[model samples]
Target: MVKKCFFFFSFLFSLTFGQRVIFGDDMSNLPGSWTLGGTPGNYWTQKSNRWFSHSHSVKCTPYDNYNNSVDVWMMRSVNISGYNLGVLTFWVWQKTEGNDFCQCQYSTDGGTNWVTLWQRAGDYSSWQAITLTNLPNNANRIRFRFYSDGSGNDEGVYIDDVILYGVNRTTTRIFLENGNYFPEGWTLGGNYNWTKVTYRYKSSPNSVKCSPINGYGYYNNQDNWIDRYFSLTNYDYGLLQFWIYYDTQNPQDSLLIQYRSGGNWFTFATFSGYANWTNYSYNIPNTADGLRFRFISDGTTTYDGVYLDDITFDGVSTPWIDLTTLSIDSPPGLVEFNDTVSVSATVANFSPYVIGTPVYYRIGNFYNALRIVDPVQPYTTVSVNFPDWIVTQPPGTYLKRCSTAYYRDSIPNNNSLTGTVTVVGNFDVGTIQIISPTGTIDSGQTVNPSAKVKNFGEGTVDFNVKLTIGSYSNTQPVSQLAPNEERVINFDPWTAQSRGNITVKCSTQLTNDINPGNDKMEGSVFVRVLDVGTIAIISPTGTIDSGIIIPKAKVKNFGNTNVDFNAKFTIGSYSDVQPVTQLAPNEERIVNFSPWVGSRGNYTAQCSTELSGDMNSGNDKASGGFSVRVRDCGIVSFVIPYDNMPVGEYNPRVRFTNFGTEIANFTARIRIGDYVGNATINNL
Candidate 1:
């Protein structure tokens, strides 16, 4: 009876070293906090069976002359974290039963079972080393369990040389022991959240980090930022741009891009918090060749320090790049039926992506259903027939947008490109066209405006060609516009009456842009009515599952005289809006925001129209966000030898577990740091 005593180290070795070695040889001795082996004749002891060796050569392999029934084997302890992995291998030979084979197993619950790795047979002794590639990168004790399978015979059975290799994965972590500091004018973000701030891979090039930054909750303290002046030397620059992330919960927080200018630092660009590490890029100009960079936290109390990583910057930064806008666009200040409106987008050679077909553009919604560059003209601007998609759509705001991510492998840009789009809401107003004034209308002159409005949206219902007269006011419903058809609206000299100045608005039903930032449009006009223009959102701005509702807006005239107006809004499918009226020259009102629940994507609402007395105009929309990804914890699926795996003092146990998603490869035994016997993780 083998009475075995075992002890295990529950804590990890706090060895602040460069790399860790995992050669799971079953050598049980004091002072060795690693090596957790159990059961004799297990995979670990197989290393002494004339097959194991320090080197990976079959020439005079030590295990080749083994007189025992065991072949070569080895393993080590590995703590599985997020997507961990390693590669290993072992010696091969024919068993006493003339079978040539072995297997590797892993145990997550304190090590007790023996599972199968990979099995090799038929002249196993002649083979140098049997390799197991995709080893699961997780926490568990891996062991090599060899089996004769009736193929291990001494007659021609020969064995030798075990070898193993592994891939070392790097993670973003604060050593706590090693930290850097910043001076005055500059500040450290997150206080201690470690979630904010930024991290640099290998600095100097001032390139955005390519690797994704690590974070768990809503804040970040790992403010890995670059200096204000890195001095972009002509030497080969490797890192270009860094990957950064900030919680959008704080409105003041932005991608505060900074540059060394005018002998001081200033902002270059400020992207909002609602941005991701996706199709975003930033680089320094060759003219400012000797400058540095750092993420600036917008000094907002309730904010997270930015996080950044994976930077790639070099000579004359590639002219080609990925161009992804906020996915929204606005051209016709206010879209009115019979009015021809054109949304213009400007592209430059600063990015290599524009190098392709004379700066062409791909148009489509978020559904991966894209329509490649169909330019109305050529070169710079990409035009879309707005009224066209609307009237054609069912009954929702059909936002249209376009972007470009370079090919992943190609020098300019090459790799997989991913994007998102949405065909939101249920209202569909067909094609939209705004007719610009052929002759310019002066400050308070009468203007006849018309737009060819279509149900470019998805819904079916009464489509009206609306016209607003002021800066921010709802439109007046005019009675002449058909789906997929055109109509014109004539206004009385000097439009509707409203206070302040007035603008023209002609919105169909909905306005859906691939990007949400720029989604509203209004026509050109000016007027001075006695009171503020009549305006109302009539619908909520934002929608979701778990959260507060977005607000609504409305404006009316307290004082009166004639006034021209324009207005646009984002609402639900209800299509009902309360009009704004009453008041003298000095009165104001705030619209109550009433949010609603619905599916994911964009939505809008509007109650716009045109009136003859000096028109008033209004435009407002709502936007917010939610996450679509959820991280998962790995599992310990299978093991062997049933609980209490019996073993000799120097024997090793073989264990195996599944990684769940992808297959892991290995050539050595995996184990916990505590073991009384030897162990080995070999080919199954």
Candidate 2:
């Protein structure tokens, strides 16, 4: 059995102490291994009688006048770059009045430049150990100093047991805050007057409070900035985390995160809305060795401002892996029962260095596969496939998860992912869908209905398929349908005898089919009447000359049935009839008729057909009219021949009649006695 593996990566912090301390002093003498500075007489001195824990401690005091300010300093030298993590620990008792405080700072350029690390005010009753964090992880020629700002009347300050030690870096946590004091090395600007107050904190005791001082509503346009810079050159990757409490009601009040780039501040993110000690983390760019970060608050005049605590800048060395994506490799469609499934995921390395780790995969109760990623480069992803998993669980859905383990992952939330996979058990099931025989079918016609049968279950099957059309139903047998396969089944011909809407259904009757809801399907189709009627005369439809006795009328059938009718045509008082025998639908015939003779005038020719049951009478009759003009036929009567005309040129007198139609001029060839000649008779 192959073991399914999963890995989870998280940042683990381990502090290893150095066997030999670089420098240690009990401060028995007046600055034995230390240098002193500031206002001449008010410098650091060893007080053997007034000390805590040890025999003697160093002390510093301010003048009784509150007008002057001074920082009497005591210094020691050590190289902080020699170890992965360097800590400066000491015991101190401070008794300062008002706003005056004792501070610890470090110098890199032999006391030329200084960076404050911690500050303490008021008083400390007993010896308290102070650990200054967020110091430069890699800095040579570094010197630590303790100083006091001399203002107001106070009992001065004392320090004992100063120790500097280096440790092997596992995971370093550089906290910018020490107990209830405000963080040092941070600069405040604009209308922001922030102070570390012990009133309200997520962890209790202390949190930095920021507010507007110019009377609430009037400070609506006030903007504040808090900035801190660090030298995190020792670590390759960095993450900045902090907690904040704010009101989400005020939309305008916001905290904007900014970073310094090319001497100018660029905003990286903006946070607004209500939260209670919500932890937020941001990735620090690799190019940011000397990175400086600032948080700006704009608005919040009427409402309360923000309280911040637990500011930390954590760093990771290299080669971190995070599982970004997870999935179950199934077929193109839905998963079926007993099918082979493979789990796969994509893992990403967000670190600057290459990583090699073990990746694990598991689905439900079964462990699927284990793989070792050889070399996952920085900011890239590697896809891993697990071993083949036969879905043995009962038919349902199960969650599948994959993960990878790495030494350091700043974001552990993205180290694993869970997805769902459905398993269909080994059984025969089908989904029947009626897709055809759902439109207007001609009456008394046979139509073949079609349906799609899909294997929606896990195994090959042989089932009985049934089709129903209206009141008629039939069953057919189908054999060997593979899983997830579809086939179209055509039923035997179904005859539609009449006009109405009817139902078409298809179903599969299998003994092993588990899902009965998808085994049957239904649809609707329409059947139309076959008999329709339309008759019209296509010819002899326009104006024409009227003397056409035997005019032709063409009759056509525009229906779906064969029709037999009597075709009748009439023009003026003349009418004729013809019998049309068994004219098929969409067929035409020429009907000729003779009209009675009439006087010259305009007459209408009407043509129609009389069927037994005509569907449309509007197309049964068609009529047209024409102007009638009679032709002239010349007639001559009562001819008087000239007696005894002997071949002489003489005019023959005759009575002529224009009997046909119009007034006419007649030319006659006369033969009286012996005269045979052509003559033009003028209008008679």
Candidate 3:
């Protein structure tokens, strides 16, 4: 960190000194005051990295070889005979190794009489402030030399902010804040918060911190501001200066400065990511007597926001033309269909010495360039309104930006502003719903279907509404429905003759409707015939005997109505019957045919449903041949060691148990993958 230079005030008038000459080089170009000598490796050249200001800084490269050191000097000649208590002040940054050194020397009798003022040896990685005291007031035509002897693997040195002043010069300080207390005349902003904090990169013990906390529930485009109001009416020429450290860049976070003059605000400067604590000075116009300064963040909060310190408003005596402000004005929002709107902007001159030239203003796709006349003085703001401005966009929302351009605008941040507008149409309609009947209905039965339509857009609508299902269709005319209003329309009663699933569709047809995607809807329905019943024997339907056995049959109502019937089974002289009650539509049930006692012989067996009014009786009765035989009623079997066997193939042992009253003769089958084999086992 570079130390601040302060003047020591004394009670004696002759001992008081003030700043006379201040020169700061951002290395945007070569310095005019100093003469360069020795080898040039951009050693004393401009660069973008490790700078104390914006964009570029001066870099001095050290010699790499340890055999012999290389020498270089940047010298400036000045006359100090008129003023006493002369002081030399500047900033230095260096990284040096052993035996590498730099010295500050002054020569009174040209280069032949050189005298050493200060020297440094070894390594230094940070920027240091150098102030030479007790300079000889009588020395005239003296040259100051910055000599460097570089050796070994060292990174070199950097020099900036050189000032030479005496006790005779006068200066006025309008404002100063060194982080020890809150600033006066400045107000904290809304939306985002700014606080005083101490960071390792800060210039002093503390600096002002502003961070746009924009994650989680927070959104972007936050308009946070910090403002200060003061009167700059006394003098015509001055400057507004401050030091800042920025942490990030555009599309992420941004820091902007803007000030108000003559009741209209204008942007001064905008900065993006990764910058050191650098100083900036802007010329103040005489017409900016009542000025309001503001700082804003665009809400892309990342890393750290911005640190601001050492804000000063100084009164200077120089002549330079400066274009201060540019802003958009009077743009239309919520325009009706095909309606026109006017666009306008404002521009201001903040310099008293130079008159303005041609300035350009652009709104959306339109642009205009106007020339500034001689009568316009400093602090005077002029509004340029485009005469043929119109809104030609279709009905929707659009974001438009307004911008201004002038070659003399030293600060370009406040030159543009963005906003959104909406357009609307006259007639629109929507189909809210299409609904089918909630409960079951029989085929060939008349049922009422319904649909709903609404005017969810602007104005009332008179349109055709249609409802259709398969071959049945109906259409109706809606007289008038206001916005956000809905009405239910019913179709003529139609019979669903087909079986299975079907779809009913409802739609609206309006020629001028702006949004047609929401004009149609669909719903599902199921249909079948009434009073149709079906019954079938599912198991043991062939070669059955009349004995103590549990037989099964299925009875179903395949229609839309309830059914009540009796299931009967018969084998020659043996027979049994069971009643089935209230089997609803599309339902199936099983019936057991058991406890049949008969003699051994060939016979015919039948299974059927007995219903008085049964429809489709072709599946109601089923018949098959049966032969009475002596056989086992039931048997159980198992294979030993069901799991965890060796990989090789093996036929495991088998065991059988007769769970019935008689001995059983059966054939067993074993299968794996696609292989199969059978073996017969009797008398189990």
Clashes of each: 263, 6, 4
Better of 1 and 3 by lDDT: 3
RMSD to native for every prediction? 48.6, 23.9, 25.8
Badly placed stretches (over 4 Å) of model 3 are 1-169, 200-203, 212-220, 289-301, 316-684
Candidate 1 lDDT tens digits, 1-684: 010110111112221111112343212221133342333433233133332322222211133333344444444466633333444544455533334344555555545543344544454444354555344455366655443433234422333322222333322211111112222123333333222123422222222321123323333322333342334444222123344444443545444556664566656655545434422234354344332333333333434334344422333212223333222343322343333334333332233222221111222321111122322221243432222222222222334333332121123332122232233343344324456432234344445555545433233334434445553333434333333344444433343333334455566544342222222345553334433543554334433333344445555553344333333333455332444444334454554434544444455455343333433334222233332122222324325434576763434435455432224444444454563333443332
TM-score on alpha carbons, each prediction = 0.18, 0.41, 0.26
**TM value for model 1:** 0.18
With a 3 Å backbone cut-off (N, CA, C), the pairs that clash in candidate 3 are: 17-167, 248-273, 249-273, 267-414
- Best-fitting candidate, scored by TM-score: 2
Per-residue lDDT tens digits for candidate 2, residues 603-627, read 6778888776564577778777765
Instruction: Point out the worst 10-residue segment of candidate 3 by lDDT.
Output: 3-12
Local distance difference test, per candidate? 0.36, 0.61, 0.58
Ten contiguous residues minimizing lDDT sum, candidate 1: 1-10
